[model samples]
Target chain A: MRKLALICVVMVLAFLPPPLLGEVDSALLQDSVTVDLPEPPAPPGNVTATDNPNDNGRAIRVTWELSADDTTGMKNVIGYRINRAEARDAADSLWTEASDILPSGTTEFIHSGDGEEDGPDYFAKNYDFYYRVHALTADTFSVSAVVGPVQAKDNWYNTGVTFVLLFVALFIILTVTFVRIARKGKELYIRPLAGIEAVDEAIGRATEMGKPTLYILGLGSAADIATIASFAILSRVAKKVAEYQTPLLVPCYEPFVMTVAQDTVRAAYMDAGRPDDYDEDSVYFVTSSQFAYVAGVMGTMIREKPATNFYLGMFHAESLLLAETGAMIGSIQIAGTDQIAQLPFFVVACDYTLIGEELYAASVYLSREPVLLGTIKAQDWAKAVVVGTILAGLLARLLVDLDFIKTVFEVSV
Target chain B: MKRQIPMMILSTIGTIFVLAYFSPGLEELEKGGSIFFDVVACFAFFLGGSNLVRVHIQKIARHNPGWGYSIVTLFGFGLMLFIGLFKLGNPLGIAGAPTEPGSWFQIIFQYCVAPLSATMYSLLAFFVASASYRAFRAKNTEATILLVAAFIILLGRTQLGLVMTSWVPDWLSIAQIPNLAVFIMTSPNLAGQRAIMIGIALGVVSMSLRLILGIERSYLGSDS
Candidate 1:
C-alpha cells in the first residue's frame, strides 16, 4: 500500500505544470523587490512633531535632509521608502510599511500613523513613532539607521476614511443599478446628429446632380464596433438612396466588412422596394494594405467624381487625405469616426463631421431603435453618477481642507 | 434563412457581452464572449485572405493591367503563409513558434512587415503638415479662432513656444502663450473630450440594446 501511494504521488508530481510547484521563484523575487530602497534622511527644517490637523494624537510629519551623498552617479540611487514602527508590549513591537515611492535626491518626505494605537512606539495616550528609510539598487537593498521614538499626532478622518470610501463605493453601485433599471423602459431623446441627418439630403443631392454616392469603409473588419456602427448608418443611408433611385458605391478595405456591406446594402435596397436596383458589383473589395486602400479610394473618387462622399468607419491618418480630396472635389463630404486623434482632421476638411461618440449615436438616431433609446437613457444615468462622484470628491476635499469635519480616517501621510 | 440564424446569433451574443459588463457574476461568461468574438474574427480572416487571393488570382488569370502587381502580391502572401505555418528555418525546427527569434518567419516580420507598417504610419507626418497648411485659413470668425488655436497648439508642441514666451514674468505666466495653450488643452479640450465621450457611451449603450433586443434587424440582410 505504501509503495502504491508513493508511485501515485510521483506520477502526479511528474505531470504537474511548472506553475503548480508552489515555488513561484519569479513572483517571489518580484514581490521581495520592495526591500531595495535608499536610507532615510535625518529630520530637517523645524521638526515640529505634533497632532495631525484632523486626526487624534496618532500621526506626525517627518521632513528629511538634503543628503549630499544622494547623487545618482557616486551611488546608483533607485528611490527612498519610509517605514514606521510602534511598540506593543514590554517584549513585543510592530512595524508597518508605506505604499508610496519617492525618487532619490529629494529633500523631504512625510511619515504618518500605521493605524495601530497600542503597537510599537505607541504609548497609552500618545503614540511613539520610529522611522527607517531603505535604499534600492538593481539587485541590492540597504536600510537607514532608525529615527524617532517620538510622540505621534492624530487626526479625526484618520478613523473615518473607511466609511467615506464605503459611501463612495455604495453610491457608485446604487447609481449604476438605478440607471440600468431606469433604462429598461425609458425613452431617451437625442438631438439631431448632423452627419446622420445629412445622409438623406446628400444622397438626394447626388441623385439630382446625376452623380453616384461614394462610400468608403476603412480597414476595420466587421466585428469592430466602429465598423458595425458604420454599417448600421450605411444601411439607413443606402435605403434612402434606393428609395430615390440614386446609385450608391461602396469600397471596403476588409473583405469581411465588404461582404457584410454588400448584404447590408442589398437588404436596404430590398426594403426600399428597389431590389432590382441593387448592384452587387457596386460594393466591392479594395486592397487590404492601408495605404494601398487609400490609393485605390482616391483613384475611385477622382474617376467617379461622386457628388457626395461618405467616409465612415474607423479611419486613421488617411482620414485627412480622403476628406481633403473630397473637399477639393467639392463633394458634400460627411465623415464620422470614433478615433479622437483623427477627429480634428475630419472636422477641418469635412463639410459635416461626426465627432467621437456621435458616430455611434448616429445609428440609433437614424434607426430609432427602442433598445438603443433605452441604452442611451441608462448611459445618461451612469453619467449623472459620475458627475455626482466628482462633486462629492470636491466637496469632501473642501471640507477636509477647511477642517469643518475632523479627519477621522487613519490614512496618514 | 441563411442570414437570419447568423444575425440572431450575432444579436444574442452581442447583447450577452454587453449585459455581462454589469450583470451579476458573469465574469467567465464575459471571457467566453470575448473568446467567441476572437473565434469569429479568426474565422473571418480566412474569408478575407481567401477573397484577397481569389481577386488577385482572377486578375492574373485574366491578364489584367495590374496582373503583374497581383502576381507579386500573391507570391508575397503565399511565401509569408508558408514560412509562418511551417516554421521554416526556426532554431527549434518545426515545433518552434513562427514569431520566435531566429525563425525565418520572425525575420520576414521584422524586416518586411514591421518596417512596411511603420512606413505607412509615418506617411501621417507629411499628410498632417499638408492638411494643416491647407485647412488652417482665416475665412470666418470660427475659422479665425480655429486658426489661432491651431497655431498656438502647433507652436506649443515645438521648442519655439518656450523660446518665444520664456520672458514672461511669473505673475503673468497664465498669459504666456505656452501656458495658455496647456491650460486650454487640459481644461476646455478635456471638457469637450469628456462630453463627447459621454455621448458616445450613451450611444453605444443604445446601439447595444437595440442589437440585443433584435430591434435593429436590417443588418440581418433582410427585414423579415
Candidate 2:
C-alpha cells in the first residue's frame, strides 16, 4: 500500500510543472531583454473576403499593404503572422488560429478549404470572424498588431475590361502591321514550318496506305500546359483524320490526359460532323511508368503499323525510343516538343519537327480562336518588349553609363 | 455545371495569384494561394497512394501478370507504414520519440529506398550513351553542325580539351575551341534559350488568363 502511494505521488509530481505555474512563464522568467518589435505595418488597400464558392465555411481572400518601412530592404522584417478571431471579442482575447501566414512583403491571402478538406481542418463554424496581421522579425522574437473585422465582400469588377483592351490592342497592331507589309508588297515572309505543312500530307499518305495515324501524347499530366497544347494539335489532326475517314489512334500515358484526349477527339469528330466515326477506345491510358509507357507506345507502333505518327508534348529519354520505333515501322513521323534535348532525335528520325516554342505556337496557328490568336499576338508584344529592352540596354551600355539607369537597371549583382 | 464551377474557381484563383505577384496589395492572396496549392497537392498524394494500393490489390486479386511484383510492392508499402508508425527498433524506445534515424524505418529508407532510386538514376548515363550513338550522325548540314557542337561540348567538359587547346596564343584566347564552345553556349545558345523561355512564359500567362476567364472550356470536356 505504501509503495503504491509513493508511485502515485511521483506521477503527480511529474505532471505538476505542466499545470499553471502560469504556463511556465518563459517570457516573465527570462530577464526583461531590451527587445524591440518592429511596428506592425498597415493592412493592404481593399482587403476583402467572401464565402468560398463550392467550399464549406472557409471565406476566401484577404489583401494588405506591404510595409513601406522595408521597401528598400527586408533584412530585419522576416514575414507577417496573420491571425483570426471572432470579431465580437477583443484583439487580446484568445484568438482563433490564423487561416494563413505570409511573408512580410506579402499582401493577400486566399483562404479556401476545398483541397484541404481531406487534409487539415482549415475552416471554422462561425462566419463572424475577424482578421489581424503582425510583422515577424528574422529572429522570430517579435510580433505586430492585429487588423480586422472587415466584413466579407462579394462585389466583382467588370471582366469585359480585359476583353475590350485585348481586342483593341490586337486588332490595331495586327491590322496595321499586315497592311504595311501588304503596301510594301514585300511578301510577309514565313519560313516553312515542316511540322505544320506536312501535317496534312502525312495524314493523306496514311490514308493512301490504308494505315492508321498514330498520336502519342507524352507522359505529362493534364495540368501541364504543354500537354494541353499537344491536345490542341491532336484536335486538328483528329479532324483531318475524320475528313480523310482515316483511322486515328491516340495512345495516352496519363489517366487524366487519357480522359481529356478522349473528350477532345470526340469533340473534334462532332465538329467535323463525323461524331459516329469517333473512336473513344482509340484514346486510352497505357500505364504511368515512363519506360513502360514508352514500351507500350513502341509496341503499338510495331503491331498497329501506323503509316503516319505524331509524337507530341513534353518528352524525356523515351523520345528517341518512340521516334526510332516509328522510323523503323516506316511511319512518316511528325514530332513536336518543348523539350530541347529531344529536338535532335525528332529532327533525325521524323519527317517534320516542331521545336521549343513552335509547339505552343502550333495550336494558336491552327485553331485561330480569336481569343487565343489575340493572346498569341499579345505574347509576341511581351517578347518584343523583352527583346527591345535587352537591345536598348546593351546599346546604352556601349554608349554611356548613366547614373539613373545604373541605379534602376543594374541587376546582375 | 459540375465541371464549369470548378473551372471557374481554378481560373479565378490562378489569375488572382498572377496579379498578386505584380501588385503589392495582392501579395497575401498569392501566399494563401501557394499554401492552398501545397495543401491540395499534399491531399492529392493520399489519393495517388490509395490508387496505387487499389491498382496493385486488384492485380493480385485478379492473378494478373506481374502479380508477384504487386505483392512485393504491397509488402513494401505495408512494412514501411508499420515500421514508421510503430517506430520499430527505435533506440529511444516507445516512451521517447519517432524518426530518430536509429529507427528501423529510417534504416530501411537509407539502406534500401535511397540506394535503389540512386541506382535507377545512374542507369541514365548508360542510356544517354546508347541514345547518343544512335541519334548522332552527320547526315546533312544541320546534322553536321549539331555534331560539331556536340563534340565541342563533350570535349570541353573533359580534361582533353585543355591538353588539346594548350598551344593556342594568349592574345587569340577565344580561338581555343573549348573556350569558343563555352562562349557559344553562354551567348547565342543562352540567348536563344532565353527567347524561347520568354515566349513559353508569355504563352503560359495567356493560357492561364484564358482558363481563369473560363474562355478555355476544352479542358473541362465542355464547350461552355
**Per-candidate local distance difference test:** 0.69, 0.67
- In model 1, the runs with Cα more than 4 Å from the true position are A1-190, A208-212, A244-249, A253-255, A276-296, A299-306, A328-330, A368-413, B1-12, B23-25, B57-72, B82-96, B99-115
Q: What's the TM-score of candidate 2 when only chain A is evaluated?
A: 0.56
Write model 2 residue lDDT over A1-413, tens digit each, in one string.
96576556545554776565455435533322323333443333344444433222345565666654435444455566566666635656667556445665787776544225466654543446666655555554233344455433322332323443454355346534543544555443333466788888999999999999998888777667778878878888888899899998887776667766877898778767899998666776555667656655666687679999998898988887788778777899888887777777777677888876677767656654555555555556666766786788777877897665544443220
TM-score, model 1 to reference: 0.63
Tell me, by lDDT, which candidate is best.
1
Which tens-of-lDDT digit does each residue in A367-396 have in candidate 1? 776655544445556567657766776688
lDDT comparing candidate 2 with the true structure: 0.67
Q: Weakest 10 consecutive residues, lDDT, candidate 1 chain A?
A: A41-50
Question: What does fnat come to for each candidate?
Answer: 0.36, 0.13
TM-score, model 2 to reference? 0.59
